[model samples]
Target: MPEKSERQLLPLADSDDRQDLRADCGSCFGLCCVALTFSKSSDFPVDKAAGTPCTNLRQDFRCGIHQKLRQKGYSGCTVYDCFGAGQKVSQATFGGTDWRQDPETARQMFDVFPVMRQLHELLWYLTEALTLPQTRPITAELRRALEKTERLTEGTPAAVAETDVAAHRADVNVLLLRTSDLVRADIRRKKKDRRGADLFGARLRGADLRGVTLRGACLIAADLRGADLRQTDLIGADFRDADLRGADLTGSIFLTQSQVNAAQGDAETKLPPFLARPTHWDRPGP
Candidate 1:
């Protein structure tokens, strides 16, 4: 949410907060590290197959090398967010019966976790869409979608395992697209259109980028100082070495922690309060 929008909801903060969509690792069954496969890449140090737990994963579901993941070349784990699906599948969907306690159900538990995760991710976005007052035109539709998605998250294990998450995502995307159009209509003027463009090393300082869709764009090392990126869709955009000093991303959608961590930002950079400034971000050069 924009900082101003954050302030607007301060009174209703307790009621509307989406903390439920965030991972609660302690309550999780190590679903992410076990159910997701990783190969030898910049993210993971060694290859691990899906359904096999990472060596660092402990019996209690905590990562033994949690603090040293990045130092040990497991940078991927640090950026992963399960949207609170782990605990839901661990406790709610399976009625708190762990895979270890009931080994026969292990495979089904693993299968359901990812599906639930996808559902929760959609819920996270839909919940945020509801928060935007600028999207009042289709707020009622978003509410219905939210209720529908919420009910799906409560489905039985068999139903979750058989769910068509991509189809559901497509249904929700319609509302989100409308919301985007309504929000961006005002700033369409004097804005750059760089949707899906390869902007690697491009110099884009102080540009008007309100409502631009930079989805999946390679923005590696781009100079984006003081840019206006309100409501820009930045999902999957590579931000490694990209300078974000003094940029305003107040209402940008789909800007994740991993993307922010890969970029360069400073004290002057404005961001949504939910995203913490990367600990490794550079100090201003004198």
Candidate 2:
């Protein structure tokens, strides 16, 4: 397991890296709660539209159920953090003003979130690349990439917010591909290209599935407890009844929140960052 410091710097962990991404929440204007939307899913028990502040959000930009969200109906809140983008858009972009005060900038802030999220995700991966001793061969290149992404984070809110994130992501993806090839070449031999394969009820506990392409695979009822699912392409994979207890799904791309909410797990199940545990799991009532 990585140390806390390392975990904080890398968003590719089993938990969120908000503590290291940035700590300027006090400077934010609560952009997330006021800008994002959610449906009444197993993860979130209420229906919320975009641009509407969550009912639990306080006037001070804090959640009323910040401590007991799982007990309440907001288990999703516990896992969602803005990666300092909230504060960045609030203070840096809009000059520390709230949407209630300046409604005109609310749409811009909302539009910028998905862009910033992509950048932040890149930062997470680049930071992880910096820590791998195996990538010593391309450490300088990786460092350059990391520094470039860091510089993007420091840009003015307007500039960062208006950036062509898709183009930037393409460039970053190219670099990451090289890095992955260099560092994961040895372990690549065992990678299974099970893209779109039906894996229902497969006992894959503790499997070494690094770099495997399991895109669109039916993983229903699969025992994936303690599996190393890093860098696996899980796009459209069905996780119903999949025992993800203690599984490490860091860097698993294209996995959606809806899919996770539809799955079954318990406290013992480890999940990717930005995803909360299912609410009714192991509970008596539906």
Candidate 3:
């Protein structure tokens, strides 16, 4: 794909807190590289099993190709960030231990990474929402919800690891519904029963859109680069110009592999289908 534009890389409403979250990766034990898996596909050029450290992961818990992962057959690595969960588990939960010294803790640390990552991801969106003047109508409610979710991140690793993250996510969805009702009331009022309305050009960058019903909607030109689309119903939705770089579309229902292949994405996009990758990214000229 063309070198992603700055606008595309850092979508409107990008938060400095989110960038700060990424900067603390060195404090992490590289949980994502060791805990996740990949298949030989267009997105990742090798097969790696879960709990196996990626070959590019250096002994110091740094990526050997950190600056040029895409050029080294590890484009998937460019898109993967643990959202500070790695450090949270590595330092706070596991007390700065690596799997090499205490192998048994590895499983617990791995299990907790996804849980903490989800909460940190929410923190990213809520923090971004708090910065938008247009979204100020619901700022109080948003702040309250944000604090509540942040508290969840600080919970004991045992509690966080065992909690039903999906249920907690649903609870947060109720809060997001109130926020969306306040902000999207204008658009919602224009369309009678916008349970699944077309939202072309809707400036939803960095918005929390988890579990929203967007079936058959036209999402062209919609800045969704960092919006949470997990478990959302996206059957037949058009995604042209809908920046998905750095967005997580995992577990989303009805999003076909072919549709993603047809859409414009880049190295930062995280797709589902386990093994498929985008084929239509606009690559830069040689």
| Candidate number with greatest TM-score | 1
TM-score of each: 0.87, 0.68, 0.62
True-vs-predicted CA distance for residue 91, candidate 2, Å: 3.6
lDDT per model, in order?
0.79, 0.67, 0.65
Q: Point out where model 1 deviates above 4 Å.
A: 1-16, 282-286
- Give the 10-residue window scoring lowest on summed lDDT in candidate 1: 1-10
lDDT string, candidate 3, 1-286, tens digits: 0110121111123222344344267788888888887899755888998888988888899988876765776655655556567787788767788887899888878888888888766665565555544456667776777777767776787888886778877776665555445444434333333245678887877776665667668887788877777646565577755777677787454455435744556777777633256443657522
Model 2, backbone clash pairs (residues 3+ apart or across chains), number: 0
Count backbone clashes in candidate 1.
0
RMSD after CA superposition, every candidate? 4.8, 6.2, 10.5
- C-alpha lDDT of residue 119 in model 2: 73
Residue 214 lDDT, candidate 1, scale 0-100: 82
Whole-model alpha-carbon lDDT for candidate 3: 0.65
